[model samples]
Target: MAKGKEARVMIILECTTCIRKSENQKSPGISRYISQKNRHNTPSRLELKKFCPYCYKHTIHVEIKK
Candidate 1:
């Protein structure tokens, strides 16, 4: 059985320079979001909001790593 709630990890993502006309700007985008109510060392699903330096806006992201 699982001991506690799944772990939550935070990853930083940068926008493609070509996509946006911005100078050297790196944003902290939520690269992962998972909801594993069992795993202990694994990440869990949760609400994450991060700002994109290139896009200059906040975007929603989901867990993509396992």
Candidate 2:
């Protein structure tokens, strides 16, 4: 049987702080997280508060295009 389109799609979430302070490469690199969400569930961009070792704090992470 042929499988239909996947309901869940993988997405990447990047730290907002890291994006703003991209110039500061003192630590290592911009903080990014790999995650998945239901395309049908969330048509808009997904945002979440996650931990960032680079920022050493929880920051808002927004989904970015792959």
Candidate 3:
């Protein structure tokens, strides 16, 4: 038996708000999250509501190139 390409792929999610205001950020780094998704299920960029410690609030985390 042979297996083809993996359907589940690892993706990096970064806070949309943080990236825009990197210069104004008090923290040293921008908040990011690690997660997986099914390629066939979500062909478009994945976005989820996640908590950003730096921003101290829930923000839209969008998929970014690993």
Candidate 4:
């Protein structure tokens, strides 16, 4: 069975720059970050600045559906 909608959700954030690099065949794999947000408190999708090892710099990590 699926979990209830009221439960806190964990979102996946992926590096934009890393994704571009990967599509261009410059990276071995995609970089991702995981974070938890309260559904009621944060209804909108979250965007965060996080360190990407592949990018070697901080980049915008946007929330993605599971």
Best by lDDT: 3
Ranking by lDDT: 3, 2, 4, 1
Instruction: Score every model by TM-score.
Output: 0.31, 0.85, 0.88, 0.80
Ordered by TM-score, highest first, the candidates read 3, 2, 4, 1
> Per-residue alpha-carbon lDDT of model 2 for 21-66, expressed as tens digits?
8765554678899999999889999999999998899999999999
Provide the lDDT at 31 for model 2: 88
Q: Check candidate 4 and list the clashing pairs.
A: none
Clashing pairs in 3: none
Local distance difference test values of all predictions, in order: 0.41, 0.90, 0.91, 0.86
Better candidate number, 2 or 3, judged by lDDT: 3
**How far off is residue 9 in model 2, in Å?**
0.4
TM-score winner: 3
Per-residue lDDT of model 4, residues 1-66, tens digit only: 886676588899998888787777868677798899999888998999999887788999989999
**Candidate number with the higher TM-score (3 or 4):** 3
Better lDDT candidate (1, 2): 2
Per-residue C-alpha lDDT of model 3 across residues 1-66, encoded as one tens digit per residue: 776988899999999999888866555578999999999899999999999998899999999997
Q: Which stretches of candidate 4 lie over 4 Å from their true place?
A: 1-4
lDDT at position 27, candidate 3: 56
